[model samples]
Target: MVDTPAPGTVRPGGRTARVRETVLRTAGDLLAQGGFEALDLAEIARRAGVGKTTVYRRWGTPGTLAADLLDDMATQSVPRADTGSIEEDLRANAHLVVKTLTEPRQGRLFKALIAASLCDEQAAEALHRFYATRIEEWAGCVTDAVQRGELPDGTDAQRVIAAVSAPLYYTLLNTGDPLTEADADRAAKAALAAARAGTWSTAAPRGRPTPNCDN
Candidate 1:
């Protein structure tokens, strides 16, 4: 006779993980299908075969849901590309960021989040944190290049990260132009040129001794 184990105790945590994944995937699908307005928590619960109480209990409000969704999106983000040079890394980062901003439903979602952040302080903080994480992640690539002598010593990593995105966002929001590969390349080249010119290196601490700092 074959032995059969009891149910419910073997994979309880796994079941909960699957449920959460289902909810997140459903929310992503709704966002992809229609913009922010289409993301009804009740509808999402129904679609995901979960309970409305569960959704509301977990996320609370629409703004909270949006903020959490962006957090998840950031978690799913691709790591910075390493191509042995700041130029290549910045170019790749710019292109990927542009791609995210120009995507169909994601574009609308960003606009919605930006508007919400303008009105709500918590939302603004969440958005700020999301961008900060991405910036820091990309900045690590530039810092690595600087350490390798590909760039001047003491280059500001955060500024290099910001330089890659600033013009792209400006063109995207103000100029109303689609960001192309050429535009990404231009931004990368300009930032790399400025960084190599020692614009960012000048801000380094003058005559500071290394206090046993290790990589």
Candidate 2:
């Protein structure tokens, strides 16, 4: 539970919000610098120049703090890019995933988060939600395609969106291979082909309109 001021006790307001932001930022910096093991809540309070009691009162544990930080990140995360065409939208999605993976701070941050979540259920759940939100955001592209008649009715937008990024993430995390634009292109093309082939249709998979990818 969050700390509450007693009667006649000063309650947190604007200044408190700013202090919380500062503490979270400080914690994020520490997390980015090192993984979960490197996180130090007391140190974060010290760096933020806030009382340790205040920090503890706001967030009870490293996991809670991390979860809250991830929540904030989700709120500020990149919105899905709409390019008005399925191909363009998929390409943009691929590029965005690549860009995020290759970014200096974000890449390592995610890596650490993923590593930390292995042993922490709350962190794991939070991470799962973050990806789910991202996937749903990207799914809009496929939904738009279906509405535009680029795809047939009843396409699995979620699976299609996941297909585009799943392999990229796999290669990045599981293998030593670097995530490149070429990889993104391959995934996009493959997903597009599969979608065209009705590989992800909701109805009987036997027959559907064949997509012409020569465009």
**Number of backbone collisions per candidate:** 0, 0
User: Cα lDDT of model 1 overall?
Assistant: 0.78
Give the residue spans of candidate 1 off by over 4 A: 1-13, 31-38, 203-215
Best by TM-score: 2
Count clashing residue pairs in model 2: 0
Candidate 1 colliding pairs, count: 0
What are the TM-scores, per candidate, against the unseen true structure? 0.79, 0.85
Candidate 1, run of 10 with poorest lDDT: 4-13
Per-residue lDDT tens digits of candidate 2, residues 1-215? 99964311233669876886787688778888998987777898899999988888777778777776776677678888888889878888888888888887877787878887887776787788888888888899999998998886788999998999988889879995888898889888889889877788876544556678997
